[model samples]
Target: MNGFNWRTLSADELEAQYNPRKSVPDFEQHFTAWVERSASARTRLPGAYDLRYGPGPLQTYDLHKPEGSATGRPLVVLIHGGYWRGLDKNTMTFTAEPFVAAGAVVVNLNYDLCPAVTLDAIVRQMQDALVHIVAKAADWGTSAARLHVIGHSAGAHLAAMMAAAPWAGDLGARPQIASLGLISGVFELEPVLHISPNQEIRLDSAMAVRNSVTRFAPKLAGPVLVAVGDDEPQAWQAQSVDFHQACRDAGTQAHLMRVANANHFNILYALADASKPLCTALLRQCGLK
Candidate 1:
């Protein structure tokens, strides 16, 4: 199934492959836990909430600083995954705990969902958020020179897009990104267009091709950790495998991790646990381990 072209698959097959919730019967349980944990994190962590990076109502983020002074610490940005249609920064706040304890400034970002805005618009919103974070890094007690991005699912797609962004040519400056942690990402957007969520995402072929990270070379001079749950559908896992290969082929340092006994939703827990391989790899990338 990994070698089969997604274009040759039937719509039903594609949906079965791409729709993660279909495979995880207790998906709601994960969401419930995340919300509860995030609330607890917000109460315990020292940070500013609802900081706006853009004019949109959803363009806000929560910044959690490390214990004591955050001066010269690495900035870790987290993007939540809701298939570009659901979820927000709030469900992701719990992910900041491990990084914050490791002495990194962590940010949980939010952006406008689909149907209300195009996927391209969401991508631009993420780029804007990165620009804002980089510009305000010093004031926040971090440095853009040691920036690390970690995203899950659709957010991972956005992080890959950021890595491939033409910052110097388009934004007039290049951000010094240290590493990218792309977990359970969809690098090939074409299959997404065939999935049920596309009704709201409204991703046409051109837009899908335009946004597919595998279609372009990454503009990064750092390592990329592309990980997926081994228990995930073969087609879904192939996305990470192929994207990691793409990054390596483009002369970027890339590593692929097949997490055992995990699924799409549960894999995020590994990211929140510093002792886990996924979290440790990211910490090492940020020079924290």
Candidate 2:
């Protein structure tokens, strides 16, 4: 790793850095454990399952409510990441436990994967899903005004996009998102174009710039928590710093958090722990603490 210059690295070198499993040998175990844990959570938790937010077959989510009847609770929408092409919402349901226990309604959402659909289409689906969630808030016995969005990896990029979306005052009933928790997110897509994971999404320069959170001014007025893993590749971790700086440059409240001893896969696990600094900071940002 000596004399490595990320700024001048070749496309292949860049791809290697962005590919976490290549560096971390036990990456497969994380996915295996996530499925087992999430399955147990679904059976133990109480709430609605497979609520459709759009016409697409993959456009559905699981809404886990608090243990008992709790009205007027804040809604925390958790978006899963698979580089926008690889994972499901169910595997991400494990994130619902801490938030639900904290008396916050948690929605684990799914969007159509890439190669099957374009990235822009997925973004639109996320926006549509959120709008539907806000519109159907009363059905879940909660208010939409206290919505918080959290996403990891590719999902984190989408969460930032959601935060930047011009939702405020766009519709009479639209909720003003309270805060954002972007965990281990890839804020800009330009570097992704050269990465191995970009095969499915097939990102072009124009699309990369269009979706990059750092490219435009931050439209979100609420606090934003941009985080990454300390053990991740330098290029991967730099995205958080760049995005946090972009938010600050735009006069928005943003914080950069580096999770110790965590990599791309395990960082999400840290966020699932309520007492962990990552989750604690996010909970506070969402007004849950």
Candidate 3:
């Protein structure tokens, strides 16, 4: 306990570090903007909506493909983050615009949240979603061989898990992930158990260890691009740095990006802007640039 990062802080103090709303006074503004932009994205882009990857109500994704060529294009899967408790794919639908325009198929995925489902169950659902997408790439007009994944906040943790899984031909005809981008992800879940956000997540010690990307390095063939806001809390930025270092130590290429003048909520918005460094980094990782 004395050596841990949270050792000097009380439980409340620790929770505050992980809670972005506390740090960003105008957090709700971001949500409001996200919803409005998402609605516009859905209407403006040509998409396949309500595609079910599993029988669960939330196990569905909305895929936005390039205007002219939908087939054989690289696929980019975006996972939304709500601390594994709240939010859905619709809030992040706007993210697909830039990637789609760049000729990448972007799929925004949804998963059953915690307090109703365990973290591991959500991870399995994400894996299943990828498998389903890869299995049907030809039908969807995407390429399984060039699949890339992106996740923000809790979704980043899930995306890291997907990148870490041992695909090894077991996916059967679907290629291994080409790369992954984790934007403001929680790499370590142990600290989360002590945070108030953990109530919904309901993570036990073992579950925390199992879900933590920092506990062990993920096996990724391509680079792991981690982006965080410079204005975010130290813990948030540290998560990306530590996870990026862990990936490097494990022989995986990793890069850390600090988005200037952005906070947790706005950093996500930055990812949607093509001119932003974070979005460019992600596109480069996917070989779209």
Report the number of the highest-lDDT candidate: 1
Q: Residues 102-192, candidate 2: write the lDDT tens digits.
A: 7888899999999899888888888888899998787776788888999988899888887674454543444578888899888777777
- So what's the TM-score on candidate 1? 0.96
Q: If ranked by lDDT, best first, what sequence of candidates would result? A: 1, 3, 2
lDDT of 3 by residue, 1-289 (tens): 1123755778777867887777788988888888999999888899889889998879999978776745688889999988899989888998888898888988899999989999988988888898898887877678888899999999999999987754435555434788988888888877887777777889999988888877677868888898888898887777888888888888998888888998888888888889988888888888889
Which pairs, if any, clash in model 3? 71-141
Runs in model 3 lying further than 4 Å from the true structure? 1-4, 165-175
- Arrange candidates by TM-score, highest first: which order? 1, 3, 2
Q: Please state the error at residue 175 of candidate 1 in Å.
A: 1.6
Compute each candidate's TM-score over C-alphas.
Answer: 0.96, 0.93, 0.94
In model 2, the runs with Cα more than 4 Å from the true position are: 1-7, 165-174
lDDT of 1 by residue, 143-238 (tens): 899999999999999999888954545654656678999999988888898889899899999999889888785857889999999999889999
- Ten residues in sequence with the least summed lDDT for candidate 3: 166-175
